[model samples]
Target: MNEHPFAEFIKILGKGKKGSRPLTQDEAYRAMTMIMNDQVEPIQLGAFMMLMRVKEETPEELAGFVAAARESFHHDTQTISADLDWSSYAGKRRHLPWFLLASLLLAENGIRVFMHGAEGHTEGRIYTRNVLAILGINAATSIDQAARQLQENNFSYLSLEHICPKLYDMINLRPMMGLRSPVHTLVRLLNPFDAAYSIQGIFHPSYRQVHQKAALLLQQPHMAVLKGEGGETERNPDMDCLVQSVHYDELSEENWPAIFERRHIKPEELNPQQLAQLWRGEFSDEYAEATVIGTAAIALKLLGKADNQQQAEALAQSYWNARDKERFST
Candidate 1:
């Protein structure tokens, strides 16, 4: 009888605690490539995913997975000139996506930002795609559309479904699996367009070092990982943010002080319109405004626009203060 091609990868992970070990970079790359290409059977896929989730992926595994995922992209990533790649996978429950406004602020100031995310996997949370729609921004259904939108608006968002349908399906398996698979972690590192700079938000502080080390292995020129509010890239202005980054083959970390001494209360209701209102200067919330600025400030420092945190914060504030107050008006 012929052996199943994907079975080896599964066995490598599912071995007993003493025998099981994470896959090497090459093995992980091949395994993911097989998964992305639909060469693995459904049962094999399930076993592989769960085994990986239980073991937790290593930096080498994540780097390899990201490499395979990027290779699966249909578009010529070189053609897209994105200054930054922002990933928003974790939906917001306690706050509106102030990070969306932060990304827009960067885009408005001539930074070509590429944003990607997934939605509908979790209920009772606000996803980026839905919020973008409410703000009259259309998500790109294809890479070609995304490229065009990036050229036209300096900002574009492609959901996971459009980026890689296979991975999208895997992420949707969360409900059945009863826990998130490694796909959730690897997808955040995709950077499909090969953008020079990428920013990631994590719900867990431990993942910060994981992402930082993985980016280093992937040879990402510039990237930052933070424990953002609601697991999105938006900073929580009330708490000090520890940003771990990789720049030019070097790994570094920095701590940005909290903007407020007291934590702001979460709004009873999350109104998406408030995002635009705050942008237009029609609505003012100290917490929201600080969130937008602090988030962008980290991005600015990563983008080399500022030498230090203070300068980054000031630059972000200036950009926010100078934003087109009427841009989002109908």
Candidate 2:
């Protein structure tokens, strides 16, 4: 009987505790390439993903997966360029996505930001795609559309379903699998547009180092990872935020102090329209405004527009203060 082509990859991960090991960069690349190409059977795919999820993916594995996923893109992403690659996969459950406003503010100030994420994978959370729609912003459906939008608006969001349908399907398997597969981790590193700077947010504090190491392995020029609010890349202004970053071959960490002395209460309900209203200066929420500015401040420092935390916060505040309130008005 002929052996299954993808079985070896599964066996490598499924071996008993002593024998099981993480795949090498090359092996991971091939395995993911096979998965993305639909060459692996459903059962095999399930086994492989669960094994990876159990062991937790190594930096090399994540780097390889990201490389394979980027290659699977339908368009040549080299043609696209952006200042920042912002990933919004976690979906906000505790608060409105203040990070969306942060990204838009950066874009308004001439920072070319390319954002990507997925939706409906988890219930009861506010995903980026839905919030963008409510703000009258359309998510880019293709690499070309993302490029055009970036060129015109300095910002564009490409959803995971459009960026890589195979991975999108894998992410949706979360509910069925009863656990998030490594796809959630790898997708955050897929800087499809090859942006100079990338920012990632994770719900778990431990994943901060995992993401930092992976970015280093991928040779990402500059990147930052934080335990953000609701696992989306929005900073929690009331809590001191620790940011792990990779710069060239060097790995570094920074601690940004909490912006508020007391933590504000979470909203009873999330209103997407409030995102725009805040941007237009028509709404006042101390916590929400602090969140937007604090989030943008970290990005500003990452982008090299500010040399220190103080400068970053000041610059972000200036951008927010100067934003054209009517830009999104209908």
Task: Write the residue-wise lDDT of candidate 1 on 148-259 in tens digits.
Answer: 9999999999999998998999999988988898999998999988999999999989999999999999999999999999899989999999999999789999999898
What TM value does model 2 have? 0.97
Clashes of each: 0, 0
Candidate 2 lDDT by residue in tens digits, 1-330 = 999999999889988988888899999999999988889999999999999988898888998898898889887767887999999999988899999999999999999999999999998999998899999999998878889999999999999888888999999999999999999999999988888899999999989999999999899999999999999998999999999999999999999999889889898888889988888888899999999999999999999999999999999999989989998797
lDDT of 1 at 246: 97
Per-candidate TM-scores read 0.98, 0.97
RMSD values, in order shown: 1.1, 1.1
Q: Which stretches in model 2 have alpha-carbon errors above 4 Å?
A: none
**How many angstroms is residue 85 displaced in model 1 relative to the true structure, after the best TM-score fit?**
0.6
Clashing pairs for predicted structure model 2, backbone only: none
Q: Judged by lDDT against the true structure, how good is candidate 1? A: 0.93
